[model samples]
Structure formats: C-alpha cells, structure tokens
Target: MTALATAPTARPRPARAWRAVMRLHRPALIFWGFFVSVVSAVLLWAYGPGGNAAAAAWQRPCTVDLCDVGYAVDIYHLAYRFCEALITFLPVLVAVWAGGLLIGRELENGTAELAWSQSVSPARWLATKLAVPAALLTAGTTLLVLLHRLLFDAHQVPKGWNWSDNGTFEANGPIAVAFPLLALALGALSGLIAGRALPGLIAGILATATASTLIGLAGPHLVPWKTSVGDLKEGYAAPSGVIYGREGAVTSTGAHIPDPCTGAGKACPAAHDIVGYYSEYHPSSQFWALQLTQTALILTVAALATAAAFTLLRRRTS
Candidate 1:
C-alpha cells in the first residue's frame, strides 16, 4: 500500500529547442543553401568547362575584317563560374534569415510572453534556437568551399578572385567568413527587435548585402598585387612573342596609345590599364609586404565589427 502510494514519478524530458527551430525555418534554410548548391552545380555543368561538349562552339581565324577575337574558351564558363561563386555568400544569408526569423516573429506576435512564462530562460531558448540553423550553415559553407575548390581545380579556372573585382581575393578574409554570420546574428536580433519574421529576414538580407558590398568594394586594395604591368619593362616581351609590357592605371590622357600586349600583326601600344588582370608575375619583385599588410588590415576590420556585435548582444537591453 505504501509502495503504491509513494510511487516515484519519472522526470519530464527537456524538449530539444533546436528541433522546433529546425521545423520552423527548414524551408528558408534549404532554399538558401541546398537549392543554391544544386542550381550552381547544374549551371556549372551545363555552361561551365566541365561540360564543354554541351557548350561547344566552332571557332576559327576571323576571315571578315573586324570579326570577333581568336578561338578561345567560351565566355559562358566565366559567367557560370561567377554564378557558382555565389555559394560563398549563401551561408551568411541563410544564417541571418534562419537565426532571426522565429525569435522576432514570436516577439511581434506576443508568443514570446508565453515562452517566457514557461521554464525556458531567454538566453537558453535563444541558444537552442540558433544552434540547428547554425550547424546547417556551417555544413553548407564547408561543403560549398570544398566543392568549389575541387571543381575549380578540375576546370583549371581561376578559383579565387575578389568578388568585387577590386583586384584582390577575400577567400581567406574575415569579411567573407563573417558576412553571413553577421547577417544571421543580425536577423536573430531583428527577430527579437523587429517584432516579425518577414521584417527580420529582410533586415538580415539588407544588412548582409550592404556589408558584402563594402567588402567587395574594399577588396582591390586588400590583397597583394599578383604583379603589376607597371612592374614590367617598358617593351618586355615573352620569348618568341612580340607582346610587350602592359600599361597600368596611369593617369595618362586616353588618346589611344599602341597595344603593347598585342602581337606583331595585331594592334600594338594600346593604352589601357592591364594591371592586376592576368595571373602573371613581373620582374624586380618585392611587393609581397604591401599585399600581406592590406589583407591583415581588411580582415581585422571585419573581425572587429563582428566582435562589437557580439559584445552588444551580451549587454542588458532596456
């Protein structure tokens, strides 16, 4: 009788907060990450160097006066290659949208009061909610970067370049790494502050886009010069070739100079800034320090911005 009366009750299991988060934002997450991956792969395969047979074009010496340039790789490969490169930014976008969606939506809807009334602490609830999406973003980023590196290597395409074409690569910079994370963090905060999911997500995307533009704009001065045309001799030419040194971003009058990079029968001394375009090195080398320092500075700015955001998050809000 006593055993029956005093039967112990089993403790209720703690609900996995991440499960709810995943259920809520699964569509957006998938759309941003996996969808991008699949589309990128298809685009690359169909129009990229990987499937040249699919994108083949007949090319021969131009018989007509003022015909197109020589037979070379199709421009589609370059275009598709840039499209696939968008993968690098997907993680940040997904992160911002997913992280900020629910929290803000709930707050806007007044559902968060019910949650607060329950046993969950705001920080713990937030952490659990952010975890699942963050894991997915991390996974997406790793897979995308790896796949890109492998595919670019296979295709012999220029794998890394400043997305902004600012003459530097941000593949190793904190801006590239932090951009999406900043978006997610901002989105999550927006969810809390913006009071609705749609607003939060939009805010996340806007903030990320703005930051990306800044990074891209700043990329040209951020990396080492992969050899400048000005660094080359005035009439330098490769062996058995009549091509000479290219003119750089000199502030000379645009009175149409000869094309130095041209061949004997082709145009010569064409006055144009051919600096930082080719993947070639020049003589009298000694520009490594400038590039390295620039990279460090830009990356430092990115890191500091992220740190400031986190620091503010840790503070008590009114």
Candidate 2:
C-alpha cells in the first residue's frame, strides 16, 4: 500500500512538450496555416484552370503584331509573380517571427526561465522549439515548391521565363525549403545572442539578409561553368543558357582577353588576333546540380546556426 501511494505518475514528456510549444505559439501557427492554405490554393488554381486559360490565350491569333495577351495571360502572370514574391520573402518573415516572438519574447518575459524550473532542460526546450517549427516550415515550403515547379514547367514561355532567373530558381527547388530553415536558425541565434526582442529582431533580419545576399552572389560559381566558343566570322554562337560572364575574345594561344573593340567594326577581331569569342554560362542541364549545391550550402549554415543557438542556451542556463 505504501509503495503504491508513493509511486510517482508517469507523464508523457513528448506529448507535453509538443503541447507546450503549440500552446505558446498558437497564434503564429494559425497565421502560418492560413498563409499556406491561401498560397496553396492560388498555386492550384494557377496550375489547373489558370494555366490552361493562359496557354489557350497564347494560341489565339492576334489582329496586330503587338496585341494584348488577354486577361487570362495577365492573371496567370500576376499569380505567378505574386507567389514567387511571397515565397522569396518567406525567409524574412520567418526571421522576424523567430527572433521577435519565438525565442526573444520568452527570454525577455522570464517565461523560458520559468519553464526551465519546471523540469524542462534548456536544451530540450530549444530542441522542441526548433523541431516543431522546422517540420512545419519544411512541410509548407515543400508543398509550395512542388506547386510552383509545376506551374513554371507548364506555363513557361521562351521570351519571359528562364530556369536560371533568381526568383524562379529559388522557388522551383529544395532551396525554397532550405532557406526558411536557415532563416529560422539565424533568427533563433540572433535572439539568443541579443537576449531582447527588438534587438534580436533587427539582428535576425540583417543576418538573414546578408546570408541570402552572399548566397545569391555565389550561386553561379557553385558549379563548374561551361564555356562556349564561336568562330570570329560566325560571331558569338553560344547556346541558350545563363550567361555569367561577358563575351570576350579568345586568342589562338587559348588565352581569354577582353574584346579590344566591341563596337569597332569587323576589323576588331583580326586587329586583336582573336580566333573566337567565348562565353561562360550554365546550361539548363545543370539546373539540378546548382540547385542541390545551393540547398546543401544553406542547410549547412542552418545547422551551424542551430548548434550555436543550443550552445548559447546551454551557457546561459548553466
């Protein structure tokens, strides 16, 4: 009887932890749910009816050479641009939420300390916080990315869209998902370091923006660029691809040098002893390679930031 009376009840730690996180961030979760739903709906519409109408409109004969593309085409372009813009800025939004609300507010309000006193180690708490959101963000972003890719693949026109465009490239692959995770980690780290909501928010935004900018600038160089050479008489005959470098003259000795005269008439090639013109670019075939490389880089940074957040939390709690 005494043994039974003295026995402590076994609480479900995982469930309780999940519930605590959900309760604390219910508002953010609700907003996220709404945002994902609306974006998904827009993407689906664009994928099915909207895409079909736009394609049909393009097939229609125009009375004039410069005719209007019709309302369907306009709407489809608007939807595509709108979705792309939102997805591109999702990381910034995530950074704001993570830095200002997720970690910073709790630390500032003493809620984190209170929770720590209630049998929740700071590490577990941080892990739960990151895990839940990372899952949610990944799921939402993955769905949006698949939808965006479908839309892009189906509705692409030769003149207006290219796989290598910044907005399109980021939205159409795993980078879409990876970037939000990176932003979340950056924001959490910023929050931990700042130990205040406003400072954390500002720092998080700056860090995320800086990281994103650097990655964007480095994206083209992540993979080996293919060079295309064309005879001087034939002019530059590079295939359609993402041109990363200016067209330059190639000497018979295989040296690449600036064109002595871009506009100096046909005499320029012979005068400079240029045998051909060369261009450095990434072809459509290398799309996945580049995308995967960028995704890996972003994920690595996210992991580092996550580790830093945990380390900071441990030091503060200990």
Best by TM-score: 2
Give candidate 2 regions above 4 Å deviation: 1-15, 64-66, 156-159, 241-243, 263-271
lDDT of 1 by residue, 1-318 (tens): 456567688989866777666666678766756665784575556435543542233233456676553333445455445655565556455545543555666766766666656776656666666566556655655555455544434453333332233211333233334445555655665555465777776776676567566655554444433433332244322222111233333224422233445543322232344322222222223233433554454446545544454454346321
Which 10-residue span in candidate 2 carries the lowest summed lDDT?
A: 237-246
Clashes of each: 16, 0
Computed on alpha carbons, the lDDT of every model, listed in order, comes to 0.49, 0.88
Could you give me the TM-score of model 2 versus the true structure? Answer: 0.90
Global CA lDDT of candidate 2, please? 0.88
Give the alpha carbon lDDT tens digit for every residue of 1-318 in model 2: 456456687876645787889898999999999989988899889889888888888887878567766798888888988999899999999999999899888889999888889888899999988999999999999999999998888774434677877698899999999999999999999999988899999999999999999988787788988888988777676776474656788998999898787778877778788899888888888889999999999999999999999998888778
lDDT of 1 at 68: 50
Per-model TM values vs. the true structure? 0.58, 0.90
